[model samples]
Target: MAELYSKARTKWACRRGMLELDILLEPFVDEAYDQLSEQDKLVFQRLLEVEDPDLFAWFMGHEACPYPELDAMVKFVLDRVRA
Candidate 1:
């Protein structure tokens, strides 16, 4: 799934068309998918459902990120991309 997501990101970046956040997150999102434990997965799911200002802070690694929330998810997502 990680490899698939990597491929998807590559395709999206190399191709010329509209791209969505969900598509960009597809790869890393699944990295910790099953590994997140049930409770964490639920938290992650809710995190995915949100796009609040808090997300921006977390994405930038600012404010130390809130608990088991989008900050961690963004870090995971960025790690995959940076890899």
Candidate 2:
């Protein structure tokens, strides 16, 4: 029950208002989030706290995420989606 709730909350957080962010984040949360380590999962949650525009820029390659941990996680998510 707790795990399900956590996943549900995470999924909810993944839903940014922008369609592009929704497409990338929703599917990644569904498919890949479960595979993450606990620390990595925390990083993902932190990523969700980032503003949509920054996330869009990071995901679209318009700008690099300045934080290394978040940047690495962004690349990891992108690579998984690409694969």
Candidate 3:
């Protein structure tokens, strides 16, 4: 499947206004995004569309993501970095 966004564009989108989000997302795009399956990449992109506050909350374990696909992708990103 063709990518929905270029790596450069995706990396740019990963740059949130919050530093903590920027720290988590930018490196994930650089380090692990290329290794993801096409479907998973799409999921990640969808996750990026969510608001920064929501992303921050989910990543910080303060709130659960309501969407299952997004939640899974969030967990995947968190697990990858935590590992």
Residue 83's C-alpha lDDT in candidate 2? 81
Write one digit per residue (lDDT tens) for candidate 2, span 1-83: 34633778999988788999889988898899889988888888889999999999999999999999999999999998888
Encode model 3's per-residue lDDT on 1-83: one tens digit a residue. 46476798899999889999999998899899999988888999899999999999999999999999999999999888877
If both were scored by TM-score, which would come out higher, candidate 2 or candidate 3?
Answer: 3
Instruction: Show the lowest summed lDDT stretch of 10 residues, model 1.
Output: 10-19
In model 2, residue pairs whose N, Cα or C atoms come closer than 3 Å (at least 3 residues apart or on different chains), thus clashing, are: none
Per-model C-alpha RMSD: 7.6, 2.3, 1.2
lDDT of 3 at 69: 95
Ranking by lDDT: 3, 2, 1
| Number of colliding residue pairs in each model | 0, 0, 0
Better of 2 and 3 by lDDT: 3
Show pairs that collide, candidate 1: none
What TM-score against the true fold does each predicted structure earn? 0.45, 0.92, 0.93
Predicted structure with the largest TM-score when compared to the true one: 3
How high a TM-score does candidate 3 get? 0.93
Residues 1-83 of candidate 1 have per-residue lDDT tens digits of 34433433433432322234544455545454545556555555555555544554565566666565666666666777568
Better of 1 and 3 by TM-score: 3
Query: Which candidate's lDDT is highest?
Result: 3
